[model samples]
Target chain A: MNRILRLFAVTLIAVVLVEVGYAIPSFSRKYKTSCSTCHYAAPMLNGFGKAFKNNGYRYPAGTDPEMTKEEPVSLGSEGYKKVWPEAIWPSDIPGTSPLSIWGIGRINYAAMNDVKWEFEFPHEVEILYAGTIGENFSFFGELEFENEDNQNEIMYPFALQYDWSPGLHIRAGMVHADPTPNHLKLTRNHYNIASFRSRNRWRFRDEQIGLEVWGAGNGSGERGGYTYRAGVVNGQGINDMNKEKDIYGKVTYKIGGLGETGGTAGAESQTSEFFIDNSVTVGGFFYKGTASRAGFNDEDFTIFGGDVDYWYDRFIVNGALMFMNSGMPGIPERKSMVYYLQGNHVIYPWLIGLIRYEWEDADTDQDAVKPVNAFIPGVTVMARANVKLVLEFKMFLDDVNKKNDTFTLQMNFGL
Target chain B: MNRIKIVVSISLLFLLSQPLFAGDIKGKVKAKGVKHSGDAVVYIEKIDGKTFDVPKDHAKMDQKNLTFIPHVLPVLAGTTVDYLNSDEVLHNVFSPETCVDKFNLGTWPKGQIRSYTFKKSGCIPVMLCNVHPEMEAYVIVLETPYHGVTAKDGTYEIKDVLPGKYELKIWHEKLKGASVVVEVPEHGEVVVNFDIKR
Candidate 1:
């Protein structure tokens, strides 16, 4: 009890200090739009937001609105310094460089026998750079500082995208792999299944070095459109030790709602106009890879999943299901299934109520870990368009339960 | 002899009234694949060997509720437009089109107005706000004053056009536009319909 109280006091003070000291903005700065324009809440993408990301961070019209041209700075006859050498050297290509910063601070308490509590002043801090190199080429890069293994670690994701047309793009570099579309959700807490799978020893959805080709059917509407992505990545994570590469793919289609009906037929570019009513999207994904474990030898992991997101008026519903099959050199094959369902409704313009249920069966065999189920209920408060506060409670259901239920309070703000 | 005289008098009266009356172009625009076709501009293309004087009155576009009140505004070439900010927060108006010289009217507070003159005819400039990226509007400059904006039902009427052959054009922000040629009679109205699709 004393340890828990001491930890709580320290966390509270740290939260107060960070909340008053720092304010950093995100992609809202590059697009010069409000956070709500693409987010149902900060970090959580709506239909339009997904389309924007799939479009290589450019407007659906195939233009980079943030682009600005700058003259080179001369250093007296020696040479000139240009932001983008390609923009001035071989040929003149208009480009813009927009830099932004993002940071999050968290405090958590877990209800256990000892009542554990802890505070992380800043769970993560990231510096983001995104823009266009010319008319058809664009890029996004992130440098991050994170708390890992009780120490600070530096990480980054870099990718370059080439836009062949409004409906076609090829992106190459180290980037986040998408096993489920909710990778961009707004809340600091994650879906139970996503956390469970990501933390597994195999590391299925972690960022990896890869090349992806993606395209969208409609210009930028929230409905009646489709998007597809396929990529090859080093399955061993950022720094690879394996020689074989993994293949992954995802396809999503918007079934019905207000659709995009603009843009010229067969044209490479489009106008920057989109309409949004209620929308829904359904998608499926697959990943196949091989990893070598120290004791287990070489193991093959195959994963397949499906997801859906729907928005109607003030209500939003999302869910995902995944099945995994694993095989080791001399061990019996293991199969498992994980799934989560979530629903959110806007009780007020600034307040949203949410509920989610998740289940995970670690293995199908008799020796498999007892099936785990969780129920989570939360509320999100929007102090402003760029700021949000979340309170979540997690309850566990299991026969041989380890006391792991938790209560979390988080604050996310952008300038 | 009396019937011949009566016919001659009627013919002369008709000829005398022809120049006194001007023709009107009225039509309904059916916009396919868009949120109700409101704010689409229907105007006359430039007439050869003819130039129009800039209107003395300035056109107004208001920024209210974080949106441009009239999403689309059409004006004669060389006419001036006034941008009014009605929101409490600061707002900026600018254009990237070279036809308008890529003008950037810096940020201003509530109730403030900024003015810009568009001298280039046949130029359609998209208006944007740096402070609010989602806020967008269009300024369409035409060579003549004969134009009307469509309502929610896609109905529009361009009144008092001189009787002649002219090309009618449609300017929509989302969909591609098509032009049609029509001959206006000396008097009465011409009812023409257009169906525009993406």
Candidate 2:
């Protein structure tokens, strides 16, 4: 590879290294409950957590008033809703501070073929805020600080959401535009397809500034139900100079489990595994965007994917497949694909064991580039309700002789 | 002489069957470490040689406005209690206690009643509903009918206690109080106060 290309890859990898999963503990404070109430662990939501998200961060059964331990402060009066034209609509803000702080400390080991390997530590920090606004509105925001090249860089992503119904809602601002799960990934590195970037730098994990409409509902008694979301985003990510906008849509259906309702758990997360229900969720999504450049002709790319998640007893298995089609004006059009299969077992409520296999077939016709195959086996331990410890060993199947294996240990705490 | 002897025997039997010298046990209870001292149960332990008949009437606990109307209800052992749902929404009643064999009354609509009988004396069971977990109440089953719940001011009175030396106990869901031996005086009210702690 050329020096410039190698440098770009290294920079991107460094950026991804600091991208850790975020678990908001502010809700726990507001509810006066433990983090286990909504998370299998922080960031990896269980059935109830999914339902809670679908309801715009409110209780799904419309029992917020009864379940909320801490009452919210009202911004406007309910008496004003009847006089809309003459008065502002009523809503409530969190009674307590809605902010949560997360610190990530890590030790990384790489068996490098060229460069000296050293352990990395205390890589990133983030300030996160998520809470409900009144009855039908909610918001989530995060400010991320990372250490790279001996410098601290900051990035902020946030969104405001409004719930129209259980089957429909609207969200605006910087948001995750893909149908597949990325923001909530348990692994240090995002799924291959979600992190895949084209030559023009269009990565799915980049929080796109956009507007999305989504909805979900629990049918009945763990029968699960449906979830659908679609969005129109600035295809080039934040602060795009081009007029072209990207659009994507996704739909999912889950059966025989607490898809999103989590009625028994009552919109609460993993509070415990005793309530884990058997479920199968299937989904499909597509993203079409144009990558613009000043000197060269614009390139258009489209990615279509299908994903599935299965939960049975203490085991959860999930997989995704994505096919990408790209047209770069001076070169011949190319097609590529990335896919991964993963499984997780609840060895204990505090301990999780997982294995993932990923393969990337780039430029089908390019014989010079061999398919990249890898295996990532990891274990996550809950040091406490608010602390998590993860250890992952990743091995590249195609580069075993090149001594390119990597292992990472990360400690994340939120308060 | 034979007729007079029979009449006297019958009269003695009738007098023995009645509570000739009964008194009222009334007092103030100070439940420490809590907001309100109300709902604490004060009752007399079972008599050594006596057992009251199970009341034919049923005790009623009403669910209204997402709350249990009577937070604490004491009933004689083997008494049937009616769980009534008066809320607009459906309500369910279940207990995790083994006293009532973990009785579960499934969801019911407004104005419906589900009943369960507590047959074990000295069994205290918490009633809960899956529909509204916050709604909680306690059922205190006792062998004696002499029981009273303290008012908000912490005053309680168990009337018509037969003259005897008996154990008087206080039961609070979140607090514990020491039991005392009380000697009842015939035909009068006894003022016994108690202090409960966490």
Candidate 3:
């Protein structure tokens, strides 16, 4: 244990050194704006940040004319005008390569009857590429490294999106299909209810290669509106070995405040006496698929869920509930339920407080693994626009009425 | 000698009062296809071979509740504007328009003020906050000082105008209105009504 602790310390020091010694400016350079323009922190997106992403990594409000001018550097009068493509008429490319890197490090201590501590330097590292090809076409891709397992994985979000209008968009590629509450939260400590082990019984995969159509009404401000997404994907995970495909769809309606109109670009300014913008979104999702297992030929799975997100000023509340039913060849039908509730409030521009409760009942028979319940409270601090620090305390009530707890601290840096 | 002095004082007082007798342009704007008709700037177009003096007092626009107060502001060319922040958050003011040289005032905290002088006339520049993308305001710089913004009821009155024929124009953030030639009488008020549309 002492040797492991020493090793962990060395790795943590190395990661911190790298972060402080090197800096790679990314999207901020492309837009000629600071990271704070879109992000509440390194990865957590504010309202404007979400709109920018919905607009295919382009400026949601509109592009500045001066930022769009491109000057060609020529090697010769008629040959090799420029190696790097400049901003063309409708296309604004700040650099030839639209790529960025994000890295995270973590230190975790767990006490499950016995106390244990571990350190992970570069808990995860991601190479992100995103930009607009033209006025309406955009693309995003990411390659990630998970250091705990010492394995490299490709996040299959390589997708192309075309904006038909502010209210309509079509995209096709690998995408996240899980309708869990934590899927959209920007945090390293994921809700245990959506963990891989839990998902095995639920038969819900996080990412799958698929084609999707999604859109929002009133993309401009945080006003009342609606958004929808529907897609079809391979039932299996990244690599599909089965012939069956999964079908999924989700729809959300927003009330109060400015709707998701895609007009966050300063085109419209609110004049109401109220200083804070408020919005609430209620959504539902349905998924049907067939999961192939080694012992069992195939199991038919159906899952349905609902979620709600509310925002007022700097406070936010999010909750989701999912119910699953599955059938196998010889076994009776199995039913399960999983749900979670989370809330976050911004105490300051650089500080936020969060609380979450998660529960899962894997089997209806009560004989299966005892129902698990977990409570988590955390705080996130922004040292800078691209630097974030999070500390969380988690308490778990496992089956058999056993109590376990964990404490974790994570640091993330992105450009 | 006392009689001559008294006569001189009376003459000067009469001369100053004569300018106050100039006609006033009073009007109401009817905006179509929009929520309210407030913040509409009504001004007189440039007079032939005429130039107005820049005012010594600066106009003010405040940042309150993550918004630029008084969504629309009209000012005479060569006037300086004071941008004040009343909210607890930091705010930035900038213009992407070339007419104002595309000036960007860096972020400032609450209770602080930044000033900028607009030199070019006949240009409407949109002001934006880099920190808050949804915060927006407009500054309409004109050559004449005879301008008034409409109230919530769409009423506006521009006073102390010299009796003459001039082009009157109205500007709205999201609407368009036609410029009309109006002759201000030597005395009393001339009522001009405008129908603006999106």
A348-373 per-residue lDDT for model 1 (tens digits):
75788988888888786745578888
Q: Ranking by TM-score, best first?
A: 2, 3, 1
**TM, every model:** 0.60, 0.76, 0.61
Which is the leading candidate under DockQ?
2
Question: Candidate 1 — which residues are off by over 4 angstroms?
Answer: A1-27, A63-97, A113-115, A181-183, A198-200, A219-223, A258-277, B1-198
Q: Name the better of 1 and 3 by TM-score.
A: 3
Measured against the true two-chain complex, the DockQ scores of the candidates, in the order shown, are: 0.06, 0.09, 0.05
True contacts kept of each: 0.10, 0.00, 0.07
Candidate 2 per-residue lDDT, tens place, A1-415, comes to 6977766655544343333345788988776656765677688776667777887786656766665777899899899899998888899999989999988888778787354454455678889999989888889888887766555656677889988877788999865575556434777767988777765767776667789988887666535888888899887645664788989988888986664644542222222142255789898999999877667767799999999989887888999999989898779887889999999888977898999999888777787778888999999998887899999988889853236788889888999
Interface C-alpha RMSD, model 1: 13.7
What lDDT score belongs to each candidate, Candidate 1 first?
A: 0.68, 0.79, 0.69
| Predicted candidate 3 versus true structure: per-residue lDDT over B14-99, tens digit per residue | 88876755799999999998888788999985888889899999999998755688899989999999999765434679988999
> Chain B TM-score of model 3, please?
0.91
As a whole number from 0 to 100, the lDDT of residue B46 in candidate 2 is 91
Residue A103, model 2: lDDT of 88
The alpha-carbon lDDT assigned to residue B125 of candidate 3 equals 97
